[model samples]
Target: MAAASQRKPATLQFFLSAFVVLWLIAAAFPFIWTLWGSFKVELDFFSISDWTNAITGERTQTTHGSPFTDAGYYGAWIQEEFWRNVLNTTLVCIFVVATSLTIGTLGGYALSRSGYKYVFWLLIIALIFRAMPPITLVSGYLPVFFDWNVWGFLPTAIIVLVAINQPFTLWMLHSFFEGIPKELDESAKVDGCTQFQAFRQVIIPVMWPGVVTTGLFSFLLAYNDFAVTSMVLAEQNRTMVPAIAAFLGTTYTEGNVMFAVAAVVSATAPLFILVMFFQRQIVSGLTAGAVKG
Candidate 1:
């Protein structure tokens, strides 16, 4: 056996560490402020003691800003609206991921397999629509949705989200399908399988990493979205991010603190879980089409 020699970095490590620390500090302040501000009343924001708006018009609470610091932390975050927002965000994320992945996977497979001028145009149009700002799409589509009786509020949001997500996921998994050898499809057809069966039984299992990766992107895209949802959803129907924004209103109360804590809990939990769950497949999918195997 050969003895292993250790490699050492010179001055780069210290500078890199300092850079990361500064960046982290910069990032941490806003969340910390939000968290801390949640605890104290709106009047207590500036003064050492709690007072009504009449005593001190200084409304913004200092404690509400702190992400890491709170009086009761997660224990105090249980409120009706908080839980409702959590449920709303979760449902939207799941639906968006599932719908986008299914539609994208099937469409991607078709696009990759067939050669048609219309498909090219469609792809280009979808890409263009996706490239445009989400607000633009929301603004253009809102009046249409408003006029229609069947598609108001949440349904409208879902339709718009699915439209946005389809292009990105289709593009991702289309490249994955292209990377696969055509012989597999032919071989499956030569056996007892049809085209749809080959896709379901053969292609899907083989390229699952790509599918999973697409799902991950869709999940996060829907989960963290605020702007489009804000435009489409009313205040009562607000999702997680919008709910967090609602916390910073003129009247800061216990509900605001609860909302902040709920924000931290819900924000981190599912996101971390999904990443950890699909960690292996996501890594492979990200690198899959980069090089020939």
Candidate 2:
């Protein structure tokens, strides 16, 4: 009986280990392939004649005199002026995250602290807005922006992204603020601190985990956004996402698809680094609101 029971446990462990190994390979394979292919020539990478040439960099050696080349990165970044798009993406993300957090922190704090009945309805309305596709909202913004003569600029896109992001931000921060004790606010008041002071000095410090988590999400949305950024901003103001799309348009016909691949790998690098650095904060923030004071 003991031997049979031990065998059953080992069988389960073997299946679980196999499942994990398979899952990891499935998730990692595409990026790994792309990274490997990025160093090879387009012909080799997409070889119809011989796919093994991609792994071996057979043609890359013929052209660049090496098994690998940085030609794609150089072409995309230096020749194609993709660094400008990177700058735009960085600026847009910074502005969107900062503005969204500022407004969301204040508004969420107010909603969480107030006992007003309308606050419930207000949150429901915000939820509805959050649920609506951002692309739908873009058409409405276009006419207004055209009339205001604010279309096709960085600030306009930043403002639009900030507005689109707000409802979710408010929802997240509201829940996070709710997890904080009301007694802290009361104590601040007892010490003659204003409501803003209580929030700025007291709640903000304790709410760092939730805020960091929310900000990461905001940064991601702004960074990864394509539809809104593309439509709102002009050619000169294009962000990384739109620029990659543009690369697809011109590079493929010019036999430079490897440039687009390299751009993708480059774009992915920041997000990878971000996750590696802030993964701990992200986990903490995600769980912070789960517990109540």
**How accurate locally, in lDDT, is each candidate?**
0.70, 0.90
Highest-TM-score candidate: 2
lDDT of 2 by residue, 1-293 (tens): 46865656678889989999999999988889999999888988999899899999889999999999999999989989899999999999999999999999999999999999999999989989988888888888899989989889999999999998998888889988887899998899899999889888898889877788899989999999988998899899999999999999998699889889999999999998998999987776566546621
Off by over 4 Å in 2: 1-8, 283-293
Best by lDDT: 2
TM-scores, all models, native as reference: 0.73, 0.93
**Model 1, position 9: C-alpha lDDT score:** 59
Would you give me the overall lDDT of model 2? 0.90
lDDT of the structure predicted as candidate 1: 0.70
lDDT of 1 by residue, 1-293 (tens): 24344434557768878899999989876556544544544334344554353133344334445323344344434544567777788778888888888888999998888778887887787678668888777778767766875333666677678888888787777777887888888899999898999998889889876787788878888988887887788777778887777765622554444445546655666766776788876676667636522
Q: Which pairs clash (backbone N, Cα, C closer than 3 Å) in model 2?
A: none
RMSD of each: 6.6, 3.2
